[model samples]
Target: MRRGRRKFDDDEADFVKRGRIEPALSEDPDLPETGDRWSTWDNALHGPDPLPEWVRTEHGAVDTELGMLKTGKEADVYLVRRAVPDTDKVSLLAAKRYRDGDHRLFHRDAGYLEGRRVRRSREMRAMTNRTAFGKELIAGQWAAAEFDALSRLWRVGQEGGTISVPYPVQLIGTELMLEFIGDHKTGEAAPRLAAVRTDREGLEDLWRQMTEALSVLARTQIAHGDLSPYNTLVHEGRLVIIDMPQIVDLIANPQGAEFMARDVRNVANWFTARGLRVDQDELIERLSYEAGLL
Candidate 1:
């Protein structure tokens, strides 16, 4: 299961000279240093087209898969260090790879596919029937949809909006590379909102931030349809919304209004249980108005 660490017999160096690994482990010589020869960068370390401008500036850094960051039913995220061949310009990227093989684990995604166009008739049939090929297709769509959503929200967030998201780097097939939300040097993921219990003022501050994020979504004609304390992250005292492959269309989906109300109610209940009284009804009304749905 370990990737970057080579099991040496005290002959070659046990670790790479200038590579990073998770849990601060030594390197593996069997793994390719530049990563294209391996699966770390999803074999996009060097491609037919040039790398993106932001990453090309690093002069084509090497990606080394450290280890698994997290695993879910649909995908598995890895901790990978992207660094120059022999220099110190390095960044840790989260490589989220959706399942692409016949071993499907996640399902029941039809609810979010309401407005998503299924271009190919056969593909649509297969997906509806839940065939092996259908599962693979759905996996790819999920990754693509999430990447698009993140890109859109991140762009608006850059304009000083309240929403915040992990910076999306690139997407290759089912593999998506994103900016590491936590400390790259340590590979520590930020705590999810469900894991945080703070003092009264701290709780109030978080609620305000959460509301700001919700308003941002409302103004953008989007709703985090699966929003829950579990999907939200608290990093450096800021709210970062994630897992939007199922993001609802505030204007397109037939159940858009219901999804919007449910989103607000789910979060409101969490805060209410934590002793924060909220005008949940009024907040939902204001947000729906902000989203131009009223």
Candidate 2:
């Protein structure tokens, strides 16, 4: 019988040398190229993206990349599972690896990075020039930024306000490992709210939940900067916000009010389109007050 290649394997050489390549594993997960430039998306070899490593080395516990869930301008999200072959210790994790290398396609980085400060002039110049090192720096910066923001918000939610977020596991350079927010046993990812066709009941519930969660963000003096239905997940009737790399600084950024308004409007518009009666003006006003933007 003929066999096929090991799909989605991290590195070809390592697997081949160690006999880790499975010849019969043909049904590997699917990951399509998202046309993200080197220096910003995932799987750009000889690029700035950092490689993934097995943090824990157990005799039977092996980590596998199921497939890519989504790809954005800055990174890609892939489903990874770590489980011991014979035991019950198992977990599914979302691995978000930022892209790097070559000329990037997106140019709106500076807008989001307005309040962000770079320490060294050399690095700043390099970043402005979009040099290889600069792109790498940007990748790390975005990854670290998301990791930090998620950690802060995740803790706050855990402590009290109950923010729905994927638990940030650990980070290695431009790759962040997050707790998967779907079926643990089946490994089915929860669809984004944008993909769901909802009834009035579902819309109302989502609106309520989203408002509460955003209120926590406003109260904490932070804005989701790029909040939309696409970046949010509704799983088991709870809305979980994802993709935090662009989280705006409510107090630090000069355009905080504008960003906050945009965020509020995006959510409000979606809810209204779904036949939910939402007060955009009043909602923005209230959120601005909570965000200390007034």
Candidate 3:
């Protein structure tokens, strides 16, 4: 939890010093040491020989550490921190490292990725195609899209009541550095909304928060394509939305209204199960009205 400059032997001192603590080991002996050091394949993937000089110079100096926070089909999120040069301070952040080639799969699923606002046919087709260059382009676009959604959520949440959002910093290639959400000392995953067992009042409060998030998205002209309990975190009695790589511009897609309705319904259903009488239709209407969509 405490952040400080990593200690290195004299031989490794040639590498740039970033402030990050070594990850603690799990009980499993078969697992590799999940910490600040690089694995064999990591070195090969980003080795001095394969990496460009400029890339090495820029990203190399930016310190990184790897360990598991969450593993999904698209990427693995790791807690990463680096020192601000000329200062002893370290910034704690979350690093979402995408699996190489995931863009092709996401792009190919046009039905899933499509919104009410249509993308150009040629561009959509190109994104779906698994060409080398196309995949790279899609990868960059996906990261940027996620960052945009996170920023939108952060700004709106800060403005409207007691919601909180993880601060996103930068997206570098497949790596997205963001504000770390969980407790630092415990190294625990933030509690997802689905994992929490709450009373009726607490559930209603969560329902209100989720509805507010949907309204924020609608007002911002963005639709979180995947908004469910699993991607929502409950921290300190507040809701924090996460995993927004698929957020789409509502104006660009014709199905934006439908998607927003579904998002509202999903949260309503979850709360209903927790003994809260939630009217999905009413919630949807409320958000639409608040967003000036009605």
Per-prediction count of colliding residue pairs? 6, 8, 6
Q: Per-residue CA lDDT of candidate 2, range 1-294, in tens? A: 889753322211111121122221123244223211111122211111122242223434555666666556677677776665666656677878777755334457776776777999999988788789988888788888888788778777777855788777667677787878877766667777777787888888888888888889899888888888778887888889998888888888888788888988888888888788988889889988888777
Q: Against the true structure, whose TM-score is highest?
A: 1
Global lDDT of model 1: 0.72
Instruction: Arrange candidates by TM-score, descending.
Output: 1, 2, 3
lDDT values for all models: 0.72, 0.70, 0.60
A best-first ranking of the candidates according to their lDDT comes to 1, 2, 3
Clashing pairs in 2: 38-100, 38-101, 39-99, 39-100, 39-101, 40-99, 40-100, 41-99
Candidate that beats the other on lDDT, 1 or 3, i.e. the better one: 1
Which 10-residue span in candidate 1 carries the lowest summed lDDT? 8-17
| Model 1 spans with C-alpha error above 4 angstroms | 1-31, 34-59
Query: Against the hidden reference, what TM-scores do the models get?
Result: 0.80, 0.77, 0.71
Candidate 3 TM-score, C-alpha based? 0.71
Model 1: number of backbone collisions: 6
For model 3, residues 80-184, the per-residue Cα lDDT tens digits are 544434444444556666666643323333443564222577655666675665556566666767876676666666567544566666565766766667766
lDDT tens digits, residue span 94-174, model 1: 777777646445555777777776889999988888788887778888888888888888877877768888877777788
